[model samples]
Target: MTRIAINGFGRIGRSILRMLLTSRAEDGFELVAINDIAPLQSCAYLFAYDSVFGPYPGDVRHEDGAIIVDGRRIPFHSVADIREVDLQGVDVLLECTGAEGGRAEVERGLEAGAGSVLISGPSDVADMTVVLGANEADLGAHRVVSNASCTTNALAPLLALLDSHWGVESGHMTTVHCYTGSQPTVDKPKANLVRSRAAALSMVPTTTSAARLIGAVLPGLDGRIEARAVRVPSASVSCIDLTVQTRKPARVDEVNAVLEQAAESPVFGWITLPLVSTDLRMRSESIVMSGRETSVSVGGLLRVFGWYDNEWGFSNRMLDVAGLMAAR
Candidate 1:
């Protein structure tokens, strides 16, 4: 089994742990250690109960020098610096600390004896950026591999299918994203202006690096895609609205057929359902094309809607990438 360690315990980290625990019998991974800056009490409480995802299906407590979630007795260690953490026999140490993860953070895990480090968020210094269904083939032998952001993962499969079928000209993507931990439940002191306002009370427009990150996974889209995000009050699942003028006039049926074909290919993670955000809470795929809502305007403009359990799906993709690396 591939021994794994996590360097953070945020939404993504806990989701990964939850997935691994639930799939222990089939997954080729083993959770050996969890290193985070949070206190043991905080980690215990947060891991056992998630407001967005509901309580874990099992009991949780601290025992035997570790936090036992359900029947798992994975050891936990709290440290101030990444370098201070230990990963003696770990095959992959997930750098789940978001912006705090990059080459430097990954190197710390390697120095302490991890076989490889997988970053759950974007990193400019990582060996390569992987968007599973799009360009996972771009992976290299380097130790640090960033899985990119949740938005980027959601965009890849949809964009790839459309671009291949109708030839994308230029695209504008608007993601109606749900609020994350980065936002405050109530208006409070924070930077970056609009985001500081009450998250549960307003729809806040924001910028995104997903467009730029897309080029890393799909080079053809380097300068052809622009993205914007609107943070909404929804607690979990989110969707992406992609508008594009195809190089060729796309017919409605043709577009539906294209997505339908992609969805049939399980590896691409496309689903042709008209489900809403809440319906996608525990979905494991990176993106599921909402065929029922997909439409092609008479003026030759194409609009595609894709839904994802942002937290759960992104974690699933991250695990897929790590699993690939482990197999290699």
Candidate 2:
């Protein structure tokens, strides 16, 4: 069995762990250890309401600097110094800390003898940044890989589709991203005063690196994309708005047809067709990719919408890439 070690127990990290436990039983991947500086009780409390696992129905006991989960007895390691943890037998190390300190963490994992390390957030030092189904083929053994943010994954297929079918001239995107843990629920005085306000009541402007990183996955799109972000009240699943200038002017129906075709392709089963506004209102929380319809102007511009469960959905894609690496 392939042993996997997960670093960080944040939202994305815990979601990835839950996903592996739920799906990897038949895939030969064993989640061996979870590492975080936070106390085991705190970690357990955070995941207490996990929809699938419900609550952690086990006691957390300390053993050899690791927290053991009762019954399952999975070790949750707490290492003050990440560099000292041994990962000699770990096949894959998933770093979901979303910290700028990713480079150091990844380096430590590689030095500990992990065969490969998959990062869930953006990092400047990874061997390559991968978007599952878009550029996963670029990953290989004994290398560090980073999965671009969920917004990037949500936009990649669309960009790839346009570039493949009708050449994309240029594009702009604005993501009304849902509030994340990084934002506060109530206004407070903080060092980073800009984001210190409550996200639930504000529409805060922010910067996004998705456009810059998306080009890495699709080289043909270099210097042709730009993005801006807004923090909204929603807790999960953010929305994306894209405007693209196609090589040739096309009707709304024609563009929608291309998206529908791409979504139906075996390669992009995650992309779903356009839905009516009423339909979306009915299943607002369903894990469907939004933006089935398109609005094409007389010019070559086309606008589209895309939605994703930033945490669960992106974690699913990350796991898919990690499993692929494990298979090799």
Candidate 3:
């Protein structure tokens, strides 16, 4: 079994734990340890009762350093810094610590003896950045990997598939995402000036590097994409509106049929399901393309819509990346 440790207990970190525990036998992973700046009880409590994913679907109880859940007694290590935590026999550290998962912090996990390290969020020094279905070819014997941001997870596969089939000239993506931990519950003076306002009560527009990040996964598309985001007051689930200017103009039905065919391909995981974000609240698939909303212009512009449970699907993809790296 691939022994794993989670270095952060934020949304992505804890969600990964949930996926691993829920699919342990099928995925062949062993949960060894969890490291976080939060106290053991707080972390355990949060794990036991999450506001977003709802309560823990399985048994989870802890007495200090160790917690029993999903029929496993995993030890929890509370630490202000990942270097301070000791994870014995860890095969991979899913560094889901968001901003804390910088290049240096990831190095600490490597020094602490993790066989490999994969950032659950974006990181600068990860040897590879993979969007599982879109670019599994990028996975190799790299010591560090980045799963990229959740939005990147939603956009990369769609763009990669479209670019391959229709020859994309350029594209624009707007992610309509739900508010995350980085935002405040109420308005305040914050770093990202615009996001300083209330997270729950406002639909804030912000910049995203997902377009630029995808270049690493799909080099040919570099400098050819524009991306942005709007954080609305929803709990979870996100959608991406992609306008692709194809190399040659195609009919609406023709463009959609391409996506429909791509959906049949297992590698891309593009499902042409006629569903909205609410329909995908607890779903696992990364991109659930809305066949009804997919459209093509007379001038070769294709507008495609896709939805995903950002926390769940992205976490599952991260685990998929972990499994691939472990096998290599």
Identify the leading candidate in terms of TM-score. Answer: 1
**Maximum-lDDT candidate:** 1
For model 3, what is the error of residue 201's alpha carbon versus the real structure, in angstroms, after optimal superposition?
A: 1.2
lDDT string for model 2 (1-328, tens) is: 7678888888877776655545444766778778898988777667655543355444544555554555355678777555567888888788877777746756888887788888887778898888865777777654788888878877776788777777889999998887877888899887767689998898888878786888898888988999889888766567778899988776766766766666654234324455432233212121344445457766668887766666766777766777787789
- Per-residue lDDT over 285-305 for candidate 3, one digit per residue giving the tens place of the 0 to 100 score: 677777778787777688998
lDDT of 2 at 247: 88
168-206 in candidate 1: lDDT tens per residue?
999999999999888888888887888898899999999
The lDDT-based order of candidates, best leading, equals 1, 3, 2
Against the true structure, candidate 2 reaches a TM-score of: 0.85
TM-score of each: 0.94, 0.85, 0.93
How many collisions between residues are there in candidate 3?
0
Alpha-carbon lDDT, every model: 0.83, 0.71, 0.80
Answer with 1 or 3, whichever has the higher TM-score.
1
Worst 10 residues of 3 by lDDT: 265-274
Query: Any runs in candidate 2 off by more than 4 Å, and if so which?
Result: 23-25, 50-70, 102-104, 189-193, 264-288
How much is 77 displaced in model 3, in angstroms? Answer: 0.7
RMSD of each: 1.8, 4.0, 2.0
